[model samples]
Target: MAQGEKGGRASRVRIWVGLFAVAGGALLVGDPAQRGETALELVGRWWPWTLLALAGLNLLRSAVPVGSLIGPLALGAVGVVGLVAVHGLQAHLVRDQLAPALLVATGAALVLSSDRMGLRTSWTRLLATGDVVVPPSVRCPVTLRAVLGELRADLGEVRGQVEVNVTAIAGHVRLTVPRASTVQVNAQGALLTRLPTRPSEFTRQPHSEGEFTIHVLGVCGAVSIARV
Candidate 1:
């Protein structure tokens, strides 16, 4: 698309993210008696599915007038198989194996549906095994998708106003950038979405050059951004 359109879309994403943050903050400050359930229970349920929420965003990455059906189909298949294998039957697709299986299945679905999903290898990064590299020389906007995967993006070479969008459904995404990189963690989840005010937490926001903007959405996963 054109530069202005891309900028507009990016701004819209930021607006939605800001709205989500504001709503979450309001929920915390609002009354407990009227909210029905206790805050603790609400948090507990949300914590586990935090990163999984990224799947919703993924499905929308390349949408159309009708809608993006790949996400629901793929995830539904995974859910059905997982449910049947784990809970429906006595199948052992649970515990430790579940995460890996989901990752593999997710990757497969995306690749298989690449034709319709607008999944061009050029602008998107998919990691199924080891680290994911963000070309140090290229300064284009990109999306990173990792399932049962590990992402190590080197953004120290990025210049200009570039957007780095990340969606991790069931794995860890680590970003290595200059110390001056600005990190905005608008991750949607139930609890502890922001890096706690601790030095050990790597997802914490860092100083920025105001050029590289990072938008990370994780579900049932984690993202750590640190200096290169």
Candidate 2:
């Protein structure tokens, strides 16, 4: 077979493999009782499986050259799984609900491993008022934070380092920047809306030679910034 054909075949196999991984992980971790519930209830009860499925689909679709929607969906799903698992683990010691926990762990792995949901050479932003939007690319250095709203990011290039700190009761935030930019953030409470902002720093200076924009949305909270 020609090189292009060989590559295409390999890509197809990879997509199938990714799909199988997701489905298998979901099945392995999911509870049959929870699966029988309504879709809304099922998601509320067993979000790990939901996240796993979406993450898998996102991974499979990424190889086929598609639009931008799946990328964000995968990111959001993984974020939910991470938040739930971390919070659950921290809140409970015995882990009475092992099934949910395992499902979440499996989904988290799928989300983290998928390239389509990972950060790329594009500007990134987050908006949150009640639901926190966690980017697969953005790794939280610290653990334990309360989220209430939404987070959003626009496509742009990022230069240098940006830092953010949010403490709000309810609201949303948006961020946009150039590609190759680095950002650090500390947040607590809920996020509600969507918008873009520049990266900020706390005690350091930016090293890049370009300017980046930062925006924060707060309902009844505070945001601090510095250069790094």
Candidate 3:
């Protein structure tokens, strides 16, 4: 799916989730006799996890659609496994060793396979040389990771406002999009973020129609999204 489409869907999900929470809160504050205690107990126990999974599903899917996403996805999976080992599996010793081992494995997988699908390997390799322009023909959402390099991706012809997941590790990434296109930015784990003037807050799109949603994760790197 295109970036904006995915973001729009996620946005709707957030809205519904928020409304549910508000309604639930109201119910909590209301007299308990109106409803049976059993329903309340059931929802109370599972509501938090349900919401977490609902949001996490979209976050992970949107942020890491490419094969490289497997790295972070695997990382999350390993974390869940570790939790199971520590609590469910009752393997405390394994917990101590799990983190370092998983880190090494994830790093190796990243180096070996940026995209196991092998679709955008060459295009991404251009990052090693610095300043690569995204072809207009490539309309689908893509994940770009930069290490000590730069990206010159243009979002002019992007029909869906480009759903590009950018990971900057001590690298500089630049995006050139249409001035008319509303650009929405969602940043996390960033040391710093420089966005357009009047840019909406994280996950907030003020001018969403025909806009781009760029998901950025920076580790000691910089990102700039300019309207050209």
The TM-scores, one per candidate, come to: 0.38, 0.26, 0.40
Q: Candidate 3 lDDT, tens digit per residue, 1-228?
A: 355545655686698799989877777676656554756776798677655543443344334433655657687767768778677865664554455445544553454333223123123422232334555556556667666555556666555556778777776677777666666777755666454454445333465435567787788777787766
Q: What C-alpha lDDT does candidate 3 achieve relative to the native structure? A: 0.58
Sort by TM-score, top down from the best: 3, 1, 2
Note the Cα lDDT for every prediction shown.
Answer: 0.53, 0.40, 0.58
Ranking by lDDT: 3, 1, 2
Model 2 deviation from the true structure expressed as Cα RMSD, one decimal place: 15.5
Give the winner by lDDT: 3
| Model 1 spans with C-alpha error above 4 angstroms | 1-127, 136-139, 189-210
> Where in model 2 is the C-alpha error above 4 Å?
1-100, 112-209, 215-223
Across 1-228, the per-residue lDDT of candidate 1 in tens digits comes to: 445545655786798799978876787675746553665665686655644544543444424311254556568667867787666754555544556545654555555343311222222334333333455555356666666555456667665566767766666666677666555554444132333233232333454553555566666666777765
User: Could you tell me how far off, in angstroms, the CA of residue 7 lies in candidate 3 after the best superposition?
Assistant: 27
**In every candidate, how many clashes are there?**
6, 58, 1
RMSD of each: 14.6, 15.5, 14.9
Better of 1 and 3 by lDDT: 3
What is the total number of backbone clashes in candidate 2?
58
Clashing residue pairs in candidate 3 (N, C-alpha, C atoms within 3 angstroms): 3-163
Cα TM-score of candidate 1: 0.38
Stretches of candidate 3 exceeding 4 Å from the true structure? 1-127, 192-209
lDDT of 2 by residue, 122-198 (tens): 21111212112234344322111213432333324323333333333343333444433444442223244222243
